[model samples]
Target: MIIMWKNDITKEIEKKRLKIRKDEDLFETVEEVFDTRTLMALYRIINKGIISEMRGVVKSGKESRVYWAKDKNDNDIAVKIYLTSSMEFRKSIFQYIQGDPRFKVVKDYRKMIYTWAQKEYKNLQIAYEVNVSVPKPIYVYENILVMEFIGENGVPAPLLKDLSVINIELFNQIIDAIKKLYNKAKIIHADLSEYNIMVRNNKIYIIDFGQAVTIEHPMSYEFLLRDIKNIVRFFRKNGIDVPDDEVIIKWIKEV
Candidate 1:
């Protein structure tokens, strides 16, 4: 009976994959790297009606690629797929996983990558709940995470690093966002910097929460200080006089 149930489930997943293939073309640029399991995950997401048409790649990174997609309702969404085959990615992600209490230490590399994707989703949810400006998470299964698209008409918003003008008001807004993310959400964006912030209509939206850790993480304070320092350095270079990193960190941690 158990073997029969397993076969039934396998047939359902294959049916979904066939339906997805008939509906749209996906993973054009990423075709070489996407294994059968990854393709199945995408099919599952489509079967759930989270995404309808999977479009072109918006951004590609060493460990993941962000795809522009449309949901069943025709709303734009960003689909992030973590590459399961990168050995370096596996090694690099260990530090963030080591001290976190939420996840148990999984030995399998693929499972670890899935956990990393889930971590980002959970972190985004925490920030969203506290009114922090982040991409609204829609769904996550295995290595694929679907979220609100940060741009319009298939173009992404400009990264803070790419912007030529850096206004003082905008600088303060980012600082306030950092404070809220810390004090309210209790998550430190360990990898925060100009590169991870998107500027849309003069508003700041934080992205890339895969490395963020809760306040209880062992390296949380250090990570927080590093985040503050990175932002402060960028603003100072742009001629926006900001408070010292230590002062900013103190303010963030203060009730």
Candidate 2:
């Protein structure tokens, strides 16, 4: 009876090991892309029960890559990882963090990247709290930020720039979203454009808040005007009779 019990236990252990191996195999390609430090950071996050599995890349950009992942409860999560080796990114993000009262100046590049990730998370949180249409922020660890994925399965919603159908109401909704971000969230999406606006389920969502600045920033109004201009330009090109950026800006500034 003891010998039979030992054989059954060994078989169960082997089955569990096989299951782990199969799960790890799914991310083999993803594992090859991360560096040692990033891998360790991801390991720490996973061990903390934040992430159950990382699937594949959902969006790829010059400075970062967003991956489709799942939490312990199998809920969809977007994991955005800032590339530490991108020297251009390191230099470009300096302007966004320079005058922000929230963070101190950091000389280390890796620390700066971490700070950038944290900044985006905080920006999303602020926007979300104010009913702005943005991905709900979950957590930020090192250079990785986890947020609510804004699409179904592993597929992300199409950018406003990619949508074939454009309507006047949608344009108006985008304008209202920007105004709300400014008045309620008190932040300017300095880099706002059609490229970062996601269209899913007939709703517009603003994204890529890494460069958003507080209203106190010296360039806040300038950034706000630029955001308005970008949205107006896009809508005009799509044949929407949009008002001028100045008019929109003046209306948004009304208290």
- Summing lDDT over every window of 10 consecutive residues in candidate 1, give the lowest-scoring window: 22-31
Off by over 4 Å in 1: 1-24, 27-30
Model 2 backbone overlap count? 0
Error in Å for residue 19 of model 1: 6.1
RMSD after Cα superposition, model 2? 2.5
The prediction achieving the highest TM-score against the true structure is 2
State each model's CA lDDT, in order.
0.90, 0.88
Candidate 2 weakest ten by summed lDDT: 22-31
RMSD to the true structure for each prediction, in A, is 6.2, 2.5
**lDDT at residue 135 of model 2 (Cα atoms):** 94
Residues 19-128 of candidate 2: C-alpha lDDT, one tens digit per residue: 78955764483556667788778878888999888888997778998999999999999999888888789879999899788888799999999999999999999999
TM-score of each: 0.90, 0.92
